[model samples]
Target: MSAPLLQIDDLSVTYWDRSLLGLRANGFEAVKRATLTVDAGQTLGLVGESGSGKSSIANALLGLVPPSGGTINFDGQDLATLRKGFPPEIRQKIQAVFQDPYSSLNPSMTVEEIVTEPLKVHTRMTRVERHEKAVELLKLVKLPETHLHRYPNEFSGGQRQRIAIATALALQPSLIVLDEPVSALDVSTQNQIINLLYERRDALGISYLLIAHDLALVHHISDRIAVMYLGHIVEEGPADRVYHQPAHPYTQALLEAVPLLDPARQRARRAERRGRVTTDMPRLSEKGCPFSGRCPHVMDRCTARMPPAFTVPDGGTARCFLLDDEPNEQGRSKD
Candidate 1:
């Protein structure tokens, strides 16, 4: 197989909290030993709850936050070694579309200026060429040429997001980091934007690191899915397998939380869930399984040491001992 367009190996991002006197205090690791890959022209959906370090990964990729450890190899170059924003050429190949379109786009700039800004910075295109390209990009996002002269405030939430996406595509970046691209829009608008992104990605042959809380929404577009909980990847595999046959307990709970369209099924699932008591997991330490506290099948050994990634039958890996070859009395690996 060919090398992936983006390869993240044991990536970690930590934030330090200092005292008022500039004394060293405590540090919080937002991402811990996270590893994943995205092939050229494919989407990798990263699904997790808020504060699960999804945005930290996005920021690390965009050079907004530096990696505390590990390497981020994008298109064969190590991003962690940059020490600053990615160089001009590398920056041009990696673009981002943020969650809030209202703030992501400069409210003062016209749509033409906003979309063409990347072209201005990355290319030697003339004003006329930039304007023409901006019009084309607007069309690509299903917006009108007339809207080119309008400001962001003049458009609806969905229109603003489309404009943001157009800006990201201006340079034809190989990878686009979408940080909750559709979470702010209404349901219909969210679907429209998702479809627009899918269309653009296929037409342009671009890769995406799509971050969202909605598993079903992400699953619809992603070729693979990775689940994050409290900064660690608990499960990852093909989207269909992860969605249909989640091997991790946390993944199962997340899928169950998605409200079903059928009322009877939804009620039945909810009733079944109520019978199980779940407690919030304790503060994550450097050792042991992160989901032990809340996991219904958690065993004594689960609290003693971190479980290795066990291969699941459905072409995925789950960070649980249930799949081990020789489980103990509490369903933990004897090893």
Candidate 2:
């Protein structure tokens, strides 16, 4: 196997605050002891419900948020040890496409200017070369050259997202963080953007950290998936293994939450109603397993102690008490 392009070990991010009593307090712990690695030409999907620290992890990687603890190793260098902002070389190598397409791009800038901004800042390319490169990138993203002079406001949501994606590729980054890149678009448009992303990855040999909540889309695009609960990664493995045979209670619950179109299973599931699970998980302040309160398979230990991530088959890992001894494989029962 090739060396990891990015390796995050036990990365944790905490927000500090104080109460009215003039006492120090932890406002929120966005991420907790999470670890993952990404290699060149590979895509890793981080999936979870809102406030699960998916975005926090991405921000920490990009240096938008300083990690309170742990290390972020990129290209064998410690990111935390670097200067306040990223070194120009490192910054240009890791770009990002945020969630909101409508808000991500500046309305004041023309498509040509938007795409060429990075080159202007980082490259000594002349005006003519920058414009040429902008057109080339537009073509790479399937946008027409005629759209170069148009403003962001003139384009639809999907087009704007494509423009944002084009901007991200302007610097020729080796890795891109796509934070819910398609969640806001129409279903049909979502497919188009996803295809564009996949195509770019293939053509550029770039890696992706796809942060999303859509299970089906993640399943289709990711080689590996990490399931997060509250502020920690509760399960992670190859997409097939994590999707088909999830061992973590949170993973199982999330899979069951996906609506099934099959009439038979839908009817049975509706009748069962036992799976009408609440979406609520504990906050960062809560102790024990984050999913313990809502987990149907929660054990006594789950409520008293947080479960450690245990390795499983197909290079997978899950944090759940039920899988602790490898003997709790019996059918689901009361907690």
Q: Give the candidate number with the greatest TM-score.
A: 1
TM-score of 2: 0.92
- Candidate 1, 143-240: lDDT as tens digits: 99999999999999999999999999999999999999999999999999999999999999999999999999999999999999999888889999
Model 1 misplaced stretches (Cα beyond 4 Å): 21-23, 277-285, 328-335
Taken over the whole model, the C-alpha lDDT of each candidate is 0.90, 0.86
Task: Give TM-scores for every candidate, taking all chains together and pairing residue i with residue i.
Answer: 0.96, 0.92
RMSD of 2: 3.9
Worst 10 residues of 2 by lDDT: 326-335
Query: Which ten-residue region of model 1 has the weakest summed lDDT?
Result: 326-335
Q: Give the per-residue Cα lDDT of candidate 2 at 132.
A: 94
Q: Judged by lDDT against the true structure, how good is candidate 1? A: 0.90
Residue-level lDDT tens digits of model 2 in 170-231: 99999999999999999899999999999999989999999998877888888899998888
